[model samples]
Target: MASMPGPTDAFARPLTDLRVSVTDRCNFRCRYCMPREIFGPDHAFLERDELLSFEEITRLVGLFTTLGVHKVRLTGGEPLLRSDLPTLIAGIAGLDRITDLALTTNGTLLPRHAADLAAAGLDRVTVSLDALDDEIHRAISDTRVPVTAVLAGIEAARAAGLPVKVNTVVKRGVNDDEITAMAAWGRREGITVRFIEYMDVGATNGWRLDDVVPAAEVVERLSTLGPLEPIGDGTPGGDVGDVQTGPGQVAERLRWSDGAGEVGVIASVTRPFCRTCSRARLSSVGELFTCLFATSGTDLRGPLRDGATDDEVVTIARDTWTHRTDRYSEERTAETARDDRVEMSYIGG
Candidate 1:
């Protein structure tokens, strides 16, 4: 396949990363994402037929690669919930243009599939674990599954030779108290722990400004555990000393001064990095979303199902990216923050 030059958005941000949601089904209903009240048993998820097949996903990825997407991250309500996911991983890995093939999951199912995923050419995995306390974790996840189960999964991923990163969404009055403990645990395990501010991704999480524990506050609290050296300028578009900063990395990297370990804080709320954002998300059903807070998406599945050629898909992708002007985080006011946006579970975080 001949490579086409990738397109840059209106802000001159090149499209380099693609997040594909494999499924919309998840077992745990986290309040910030799939709140139990909204995603209840009665809630209707996409039918199996509605999801993009492995072949279709691979085909789109091939087109995306031509448009300058070098990294592909598989996500979902729970990507592991999708059946035979390793096969999909292997298919995407076979692509020469895809330099990085990763997945983000809740970590409960990693114990069962981590080895298989690694063998199938998965480069890395990011596990979402909000709290270390069993009760806090249960309250956050709204599932009976305990913290030990998730920890075991993390170990399983490491044992399978897959580098792991733990993501924690710190919300005030929810699990903010566990920030230090979570960071210490990740340090002990020699894994990078990233703290994310509670964001208003969807309308159902009861998102309130007061609920957010700013990244600065998180850093302050983590510093109490040990001296934390700013790993970078801690500003948008700043250089990362020796570490290579990716195209759309929102996390401000930091390291413990004593060399225990490194941690990251994604202050999307307090310090938005929208200017350097270069990611495009595709839902399980193939809707292309340029922004996480977008209310609508371009229906790529329709074109794919209609037997549109690769050139046609590429045109749509390039045009959509070229016109992209989304910067929700930077412009998030109280009024605009409550706009009806796509669910984080449906499009991946």
Candidate 2:
């Protein structure tokens, strides 16, 4: 038996979570994410061979596991759009070191893949659903994708025994009106609805400081339906803040000082939590991103393809994480207001 390697951060900002983008392709043309105009029919995505193979990804995951990554999330432009993604899920699940394994998807393809993903050892799922109405959803996403597809997908995930979480990005003058309705939908479906403040992760979204519907407004709107009690704060892994919503008012995962179903806000725009951001993202092309708003990443593809040793990769990974001082959202209104940032599609959300 071999002993595990010691950690690098003394559990300070430890590498506990890894988000791997399986593909840079998606089905919808979300205006904020991957607008069709920028990623039109002529867009050149990475070829199948250019992507990190499941075998290669698993090797890296094994290394990440040894370096203290206990949770893994599969993300992408849309993860299910990738071929045989459940196979990749199973491969990661086989690694016993991972305590929590999850996937984030657009939910357009989830109805077809939920059970298979759960069977592949996926522990949970987070679905990106901006609206409940078909027309509004299509308009917001800049695609004709029906909201019923997402609803059906959520149902399928529930039936598959996967704990479902719904993420709604609240963009002012867009889908912000749906906050209450979205929270209602989540409560009815037994899903945790997390409202995320509109962020300027990339330069393509036409992000303006005024376009951001603050997290406080999200709570206020949802409070219209029912009284929202402040559930105590959760861990720093996701920067989730407390708010509970329900009819009977019974909260589950969130330890509510007053009982109700849990609701949270990812205050990326107003209350940036970059200091506690412990997650790292790996692009489908094998680039490693230290922060979500990063303009560029260290190209691990070259080194990995060239047969870099695990020790070398891990050292690079640690150095990158330790040296990271990104606070993009916090500085956006000031320093980055005039700067151009990378598109979210290239890095996955």
Pairs that collide in candidate 1 are none
lDDT (10s digit) by residue, model 1, range 1-349: 5778789998999998899999999989999999998999899999999999999999999889999888899999999999999999999999988888889999999999999999999999999999999999999999999999999999999999999999999999989999999998888889999999999997889888999999988988998889887765765433534323544777788888889978998888998889999899999999999999999899999999998988888899899999999999999988987789999999999
Error of 2 at 46 (Å): 1.4
Q: State the lDDT of candidate 2 residue by residue for 154-213, as single tens digits.
A: 888989999888888888888888888888777765678888887777777777889889
What is each predicted model's overall lDDT from 0 to 1? 0.90, 0.76
Residue-pair clashes, model 2 = 3
lDDT of 1 at 112: 97
The alpha-carbon deviation from the true structure for residue 295 of candidate 2, after best TM-score superposition, in angstroms, is 1.1
Query: What global local distance difference test value does model 2 have?
Result: 0.76
Model 1 scores what on Cα lDDT? 0.90
Q: What are the root-mean-square deviations of the candidates from the true structure over C-alphas?
A: 1.5, 4.5
